[model samples]
Target: MSDIQIRPVTENDHAAWLPLWQAYLTFYKTELSDAVIASTWARFLDRSEPTNAALAWQDGKAVGMVHFIYHRSNWSIANACYLQDLLVAPEQRGTGVGRLLIEHVYKTAKANGCDKVHWLTHETNATAIQLYERIAERPGYIQFRKMI
Candidate 1:
């Protein structure tokens, strides 16, 4: 794990970040338009945007990516951090890359005075759930959404 370095993405990191982003969408069995993808990448590079992204690199190759957002929460005075997406390469799944990326978010959020960090995962993703369970508590809140 010492060789794996997790850092926030810079403008130069898009070449390294794209494939991982695509892989994440594929893992979730979803797809986004090119315009939406472009907007997302741009948000990470925009200083005024509350969205942020980071990647885990090992042996000079990006092996994982995490995207999070800071937003106002009615229940808390400080903003809350929502970890929107987390993905580790298929071959690197159990090697702690996911945890490293998540911990990076935790530290970043704390430094920014966030009230808490939270995320959701598909119920069928047991492997990730195992890792998540060890590092964070399940708040037992069911998510209900109506897509516009």
Candidate 2:
């Protein structure tokens, strides 16, 4: 925790950032096309886009990354922040990197005047669930979706 540094993803960080992003998608058993990946990276670097990304570095090595988005919400007057993606290197798990990244989002959301910050995890992600339980309440809202 003491050596970990979490910072915004800069334009020059593409190489350092790609592996972490690919690992995250792999963890979820999802495969995205190169075009989608390119677009997402572009959005992260675009200042006018509501999407943002941050990387966690330790000993000058990038070990984790988190991506979030800000959008208007009908339930709240202020914008809502969604923590869309978060991943820490397998070796870095249990070392507090994930928590630090989440805390970064919390602070960023507040600074941006967002009313809430939320995220979803697969039910089988017990490790993350434990951490989330300690930091947030379970709102008990089940999610349902259909792809067109």
Candidate 3:
């Protein structure tokens, strides 16, 4: 239990958000173009975009971040919220920052008329899976994707 404050990302958050974003990319062993990063930051600040972000702060420093998207769902009348990205600063891991960020997304989705909030993690991420299992139930669905 840590004193973490979670809030929606603002235009001013770009500077603080970049390192976290890069660290997250590095963790996945993936790289993106500068153009892509710029576009993503823009989307986070654009109210018209389905993509959005939030940050978790502790002692005036950002400790974690989450990015999510809202989209129509075939099974539900309300839109579904897909939590696309989440990261906790290495020094702040295990400090409840990740859970707080997730809870923020859950509240945000509910406030925005989402019927559900869901996310996916790599099968090998055991540490994250442990916390996720405690807070959420796996619907037992396997994900398959084709990158074009």
lDDT score of residue 145 within candidate 3:
89
* lDDT tens digits, residue span 60-91, model 3: 88889999999999999999999999999988
User: At residue 73, what lDDT does model 2 achieve?
Assistant: 98
Q: Over 4 Å off in model 2, which ranges?
A: none
CA RMSD of all predictions: 0.9, 0.8, 0.9
Evaluate all candidate structures by whole-model CA lDDT and list the values in order: 0.95, 0.95, 0.93
lDDT of candidate 2 over 21-137, digit per residue (tens) = 999999999999999999999999999999999999998899999999999999989999999999989999998999999999999999999979999999999999999999888
What tens digits encode model 1's per-residue C-alpha lDDT throughout 1-148?
5599999999999999999999989988999999999999999999899999999999999999999999999998999999999999999989899999999999999999997999999999999999999999998999999999
As a whole number from 0 to 100, the lDDT of residue 7 in candidate 1 is 94
**Consecutive 10-residue window with the lowest summed lDDT within model 1:** 1-10
Model 1, position 8: C-alpha lDDT score: 94
Give the 10-residue window scoring lowest on summed lDDT in candidate 3: 1-10
